[model samples]
Target chain A: MILKSKVAGKLLRIMLISSIIFAVISLVTTFLFVYNEQLYLKIYKFDQFISVFYMILYYLLIIVYLVWLYKAHKDLVELNTMYPITPKGALARVMIPIYSLWGMWNVYSTMYDHFRPIKSTEKLGSQLKVFIPFYYFLFLITNGLNRVLLKSNTGLYEVSDILYLVSYSLDLILLFVFLKMVNIVMKALDLLMVVKQDIIDDTQDVSGQPKVSS
Target chain B: MNLITKIKEKKEYSLAIILLIIPLIAAVVMMYPKHEEFVATGDITSVEELGVEGSVYFTYVHEGIIENLYEKFSVSLTSRNEIEFSSLDQHQYENYTAYYETSDKYKHNTIVNAVQNAEVKTDSQTIKISEKSQKIMEKSSDYIGDSFGLMIAIGLIEEWNDEDFSQNNQYIISGTGTIEYDGTVGSVGAIRHKLLSAEMNDVDIFFVPKDREYYADKNFSNQVEAKKVVKEEQLTVKVIPVANLDEALEYLRKLP
Candidate 1:
């Protein structure tokens, strides 16, 4: 019992550590995405090449981190004898990278290829419509980890800043929500393992068979 | 373990589904473009002008008989022809001068003859034996409205089409106008006073085409002198001159 508890605790720790690392990486990348593009445009005036390169590198790091996380998750699940790998974990593992990359590709296309300074109020509204959704997802994931990365300003002169702040804050909130969902997933996995262990113990007398050690 | 079971059983897949849909919606919106439309209204006119300020010197010899004296009389005529003309009035004289100096040389040399021959001056004004044209009004581009509100008050001018021409609206109205003085001080006095009242009454539009032409044409020194009359339509509803229909339409669209 002690050994099993220790092993499960170790797995839980691994999951927590990996999730934290993943959240941190995603948060930093998003911050870099916003700050480097927006602030650098005003202050540093970096060219398009540098801006695009920064984005690519930022996303690449996120991809590598996610891959490392998934491998850790797979390894941890392989060690568990109490339950089979949940289909939800499999689905999450498949979706996280694919959808993430899809989202990143969308950002790349919009920023590098389609980006233009808005010329009119009507155009600005249309552009915001296209942009708000993808950012909303990023928001959910980021805010879940208790990180607040957006600021606000007032008046016409700071209108752009206010919009930026609001959009990023909303994105962070969405990201946080997603992270909570991930936590729910992790907790459910823990409960499933506990239930499976309970079932195996209860069935030992009926089959008159030696219980498999968890 | 049941936590994972719950995650497996009731996980929301809609977020990913929403992600897929947004881009498609964006793509549809981006691909379809809307055409912009502009509305315009007003009087339209164009103006051309010509001015000549020079002295004419001519000498002629004539045989004259007075009662008992038959004598040779030599007359020298020297005068200043300081004329300011609108291009419309000068159009007839320009062709006359061109033909007289080149083809005709001398035979049919009167200004009347020349006017009779021109393609544009098909209708000639006959001098009435009992009375002459009291005043001739000529309209020109320079014939601007005396008061800004006159154009708005008159039904003739509107910036944009309104369902009702009410007492209040902010839109521009433009037109050229002229009033003639019939050589008599009395008539001039009456017309001037009438003009003032007409402006106040929003009846200023009636003075433009006919009244102005009668006055200005009579004021001109001679038929040879240039006279300008701004066309009625040219006064407000501005239209661009283009060589072709397509170009004209394009130009019209570009107007404010």
Candidate 2:
């Protein structure tokens, strides 16, 4: 299940861009609902339609992202046999509910470490160590607040509304951070591929054979 | 490196710089206050229909620091059958009043005098408060601070003038401030939250104490803070600073 770095990078870029778009739309819709309740209610059907459409698209995108992540993890596992988690374990960690929060950190950390050895020039691994944990914190808090909001019937709707809005804004910020992280990972993978090809070329040269062209 | 590789590296560097700058730009945009236009005119008819047509609706200044910029609430007069004095959520009125009664009797006397004045000024025979109103006051005790007594007094006055409150005014009026025995409007905290609440309720005019415009060591005045919040939230509610209850009433009376 070795995924090509190029394909994986492209997938990550797509995910990043799409996530940004989705976040922007979510923020705009939230603001619309907050600022103009009457107008938003009048177009409630259309708003619901858009929300459902985005939910479906988001789930589909997450599936694709998870698949790409699994493959990337597999590649890293093969490259680093002494990796802490096996490819199967990494995938399971990410898929399982509640565990996924910690699992995501594990997966990203593993990916970061695997890429670190191949490309020492980019300190992306250290950056991910910070960004990934911070992202997870924001993610957990947002989801936790959302659950609280759903269950509570206390007449403090305004307080809950403020909390929800703050959570959502934090989520938007996490998206930006996530995109930067993906970019760093993609760059590392690109460098790793280049480094691996150079090694192969050097070996061919030493074996008295002509350099293999790409 | 080959020429193609060099060109690619340059492109990537440029892209990275742009990516790094995006979040910084977003932070600046969010923090920098934008100017907003506020319409002073409100639909008085709509407010009247809410059964508080002539009632002097008091808005609470939600000054507690909040992360959400778009939180919404409204000003409304809850009809009550009886008036019950109660403590605020976080701070007990007795602690402050009792302490002031002995240690700082001047401040305590001022508060007591204000409450008494508000009561005496109101036609209490016709005005009454309900349990729901008491609950709302209790819930908002933290934001309303020690102004609960003054608010009750104003509520009674509004209830008394319920018939003539909206007769001359065409715009809905909402306000946050303490009413004194001398008809002076004292400054309150959380003007930003109160302004947003008024806007959420579609209030036309929000009255604040003119003296609240500035305080020691504060960068922005109450009016400026209200404007900034209004702009940030993209609300269309107007904020008017008043020196006293008479000024607020005069402004409301002048409304077409």
Worst 10 residues of 1 chain B by lDDT: B68-77
Cα-based lDDT at residue B63, candidate 2: 25
The candidate 2 chain B region of ten consecutive residues with least summed lDDT is: B68-77
For B12-44, candidate 1 gives per-residue lDDT tens digits of 323223332443344344333222111111222
TM-score for all models, in order of appearance? 0.22, 0.42
User: Residue A57 of model 1: what lDDT?
Assistant: 39
Q: For residues A67-169, write the lDDT of model 2, one tens digit per residue.
A: 6566665655554467677657877987899899778787777776665555462487777777887777877887787666554433234344566567568
User: By DockQ, who's the top model here?
Assistant: 2
Q: Candidate 2, which segments miss by more than 4 Å at Cα?
A: A1-5, A42-46, A117-121, A152-159, A206-214, B1-256
